[model samples]
Target: MLERSTKIESPGVLKAGNPNKSLASWQGRKTEIAQIQQWLTDKNTFLIGIEGIGGTGKSMLATKIYDEIADFPKRFWADVSNGAGFSDLARQVLSEFGFPVPEQETQLVEALVGCLRSGQFLLIIDNLESLLQPDRQWGSLFYGDFFQAWVEDGGNSKVIVTTRERPELKGFEWLTLKGLQVDEGVALLTVLGIRGDLTQFVELVDGHPLLLRLVADLLKEEYSQDPDLSRLADLGLGNLRQLLTDSQVVGIHHRKNVGMVLVLDASFNRLNELQKALLLNISVYRGAVDSAAAVAMLPGSSAPEIEEELRNLVKRSLLVDKLNGKRRFDFQPLILAYVRYQAGDQSEAHQKAIDYYRSIAKQPPWKTKDDVKEYLEIFDHFYQLQDYNSAFDSIRICNDFLTLRGYYVDKVELYGQLVSKWEEIGARENRNYQAALIFLGNAYDSLGQYQRAIEFYQQSLEISREIGDRNGEGKSLNNLGNAYNSLGQYQRAIEFFQQSLEISREIGDRNGEGASLGNLGNAYNSLGQYQRAIEFHQQSLEIKRDIGDRNGEGASLGNLGNAYNSLGQYQRAIEFLQQSLEIFKEIGDRNGEGASLISLGNAYNSLGQYQRAIEFLQQSLEISKEIGDRNGEGASLGNLGNAYNSLGQYQRAIEF
Candidate 1:
């Protein structure tokens, strides 16, 4: 399987705001509690804003803090999830604080203002994001003159506003909530008595308190039917995501009753049609989107208008900044699920995204550093839609461009899915099915799973032979040889390579012929047959040159260098490696460039040119790191260490 650069955590949590709460039962949020208490007791702070995504424990934290202040006699709490006007809010506030509810809107505002100014009071405004409406006649409760007057008055009063979105108004002390610690999240699940080892899933929820609680409750019900917990074990993080909003499972349990859709709908219902369109369109992309890509996705909307809407969505906590301060955004998983379903049949929008990305995939000379991320993103999106055509196309490009770019884990998963999709779509004898199997084989081979690689390659070979696809059969045979070579079965590898070479010649596929020739050379080299390896590499090089395949030519030259290095012909190895390195650089194939540098380093090391070996190895390491090739980085580091060891710099080698 391919490895990911970073393991992405699921949606984040909002911590408890008061220390007095039972950590044993509710789980620990000691630090957040301490901070909120400090702000509450401080004379300088008037308004405190608690902001986080839905199910992140915003309301829980606010309520905990509200309960903590036992002596603050004039206290009130209001739920604004149902849209309420300023007059209605003021009436509720005054009535809750033991003041008479005035009949007129003007009288209610006067009474609420008078009550706040008269004494120290605590006003907890729940769901402040829902109250933000540009068209509402009484939308100014938080943004207008009255709220400003309360802050300016600086009386013995503190107002806590719990919202998913951060209010635009200034002078408020903000406490942005984060996910809970692993231990706290585990404790929460333990308290719920969910019959499963949920430690792996703790990070999946990003320690969101409500999500943890709800998932625990759901798992409890599931485990009641089957106590083994193995039923839930097969469920991945995506399935865990479904559990959060699964109405059958979630039901009306505490904060779970509030529901993900209800929280999102508050902000969603307020968005203009264009903004809604933009959100729905972008939700199809499970990966990050930069401003330019987002703009391109919105065809008819003006650039400025789209930009403003994106900003608004960010402010409303609908779209989160993926690259902080980079104007790149991605939706929270729950929010994305909501938008994907609620945005009303976005097949056209999905088709638009597919077309745009597929066009990018078709463009040649894909710059590795710039285009790989986009290709991977598109690959993921296409796979999610079960669009096999686009998925295979995008992933094929990604296999070439991003195979060494530290996306092997993602590729393994994608290719495995593609294999299943081909089977599901009844593409048993289709060329794409063989290709998917080959891709899966390559992924497993990269991960050093030679047996798994062989299994896939064998499957591919069977399908190719069944369909009489001579070209695919050749490719499958060559790859089978590679998997065997990796497993140290050099004789077996050579047999497969010879078979592949014969098939390629029969089919007149010069590309396949050169590939099988190069692979045969590699198998021979592994078996220590230097002369035979050189002969095969020379033949492959000739075919590559005749066919004008510069990339293949470079690979053959590198293979020859490797063979020479094995034979202790250090100078000869360096000569071929230098040519290969130049060709790789000229072609902007960083993976190839890095491999050639490693070869040159090994050649120098074999010649006892330790200093020169160090130089080449260091260059390889730099290129590997720059190109995000972790396996290459590891190889370069090992080579560098070996060079340093030869020079008697043991400590320096250890550092490397």
Candidate 2:
């Protein structure tokens, strides 16, 4: 049995109080607060949903309600805006309750529901809109299941969820939080120390909380010396308000957003050059922006200068300072859209971001998750600049890392986009286009879509031959052989491998020759030609050593072990497999590591060491799941079952 750790540590601190202190001093929302308090106190109401548009002060209202609800024995706040998923939230909750969280998704959900039912806890899930799917549904079935369970079953606990979009769920009171009342908006302006009769100004902004705050901040800074309501035209509000009012005839949605855009535009015009440049440049990023990235985006600006500018933007409400684990900056969705709109034709900025990310990356075969993330950004920047060739090149450089990490679905999508772009530009004959086809084929092969894989590989082969590219032709042949091998067509695979080997030798491509030999060995092993497979694997191993290809050498060694194991040489197989495992670990090739573990488990099982085999297979199963290798996961489960069956533990075997 696997000795699973039961220790539980919180991924984030669960302080049981109002987390949004920034809005503590702000007034308004008394009526909203009272209604939410009633829902919290109501025994029948288990879930309270607060929904609104972007700038309507939903979070602020939730914070107020949270602070006022002091009767609950437990309170937990989770901010989902930083891209935390359902599992992350569950882990935090379970840890807070001091319960061990299971690794499996279903088990985790069950544990969380049990915890929620066990107490009268108050849970506030903020920015739930961030976790909602693009189609306005729950992003995960687990989310739906968890919430549904909470509603169907009686629980002492109450849940508060705040979102820009309302989720369609039953057994809940939905509060459509709108803009503040005119009196509340005027009070906010007054509190901000704006010395004016701001009733007309507040009414014009439709009592939008964030817009009122932003306009006040701008006025406080720019017009502090004069501080008169008559000089509002100096800040462009006169013409801007007219434009927004006239545009209300377009649509209600447009009318709602036009006020925000006009306010953002007025605020943007007041920024200094560096501040404007920083916002425009960082707007290209799809996620949060740290100071380091901010500084990189603006060349000739020192770190201190950039930090000051970032703070200035945060103060001006143009950027949100996300003080989670790190002090990073992000924009509200509307703000990001506004800045990106203002940054039309930001190809130069995108290129700068690309260069900065590339500069920080370690040379290819990126080992860290952070490196892969940066490469993803680089690819996006290239795509934004319409440099599809460079974008695909970045994808090519990170292809192995992506594969090892089980990013096949994402890889397929990226390559598909690149292929469509190439076809659009009539560049199907380009080398990158051929590479994209091969990449798509490889992704499909990894995903077990062998027929689709064959289609793309065939297209790549045709393109390679048409362009007279021998190396690409050899690669296509090798990939096709691998796909056939996966499909159990060993003889067909061998024929493709033989052709690939011939091309490699003719082109003097030693690396390609080694890959072809290794693939041939795999096909022969599948055919039960143990001695012949060993011979081919040995040749491939020698070439890998000569070329210093550690990953390939490890793969060849594992293949040799597999062949030996098939010949009943269990001890020899163990030694070779162990060496292969070590190499894969050193190279950070998680996919290879999992394969070697599975082979080792099989060898141990052959020796009748069922307990040891179970341990190895379990480890392999974890790695397979981590790297998204569905085939490896199935193999690990099957191997473990065989070991359990050998021990006559039929029930345990069936569980596997």
Write down the worst ten-residue block by lDDT for model 1. 1-10
Give the true-structure RMSD of model 1: 21.8
CA-RMSD of model 2: 8.6
TM-score of each: 0.56, 0.69
CA RMSD for every model? 21.8, 8.6
Q: How many residue pairs clash in each candidate?
A: 4, 0
Global lDDT for candidate 1? Answer: 0.70
Q: Check candidate 2 and list the clashing pairs.
A: none
**Best by the TM-score measure:** 2
Highest lDDT: which candidate? 2
Clash pairs, model 1 backbone? 2-408, 2-409, 3-409, 14-56
Clashes of 1: 4
lDDT digits (tens) for residues 290-408 of candidate 2? 89999888778999999988998987888878776778887766677678779888888888888888888677544333556667777777876788988888867878766665455
Question: Tens-digit lDDT track for model 1 on 1-656?
Answer: 00001111110011111212232357787888898888878988888898876667776787687876565776777655433335446655675667765433334545777888777888887766654543322233323555666677766778888776665566888898866888888877777665566676676456767556544444443345643334543333334445555656542332242334443444466568888889988876545576666766787777788878887676555775544445567664456656767866666666777666666554544433245545655665666566777778866765765466433434556677678888887888766777778887886786667898899999998988888888888888998998999999999989999999999998799999999999999888888899999999999999999999999999999999999888888899899999999999999888899999999998988899889988999999998778667668878988899899999999998977
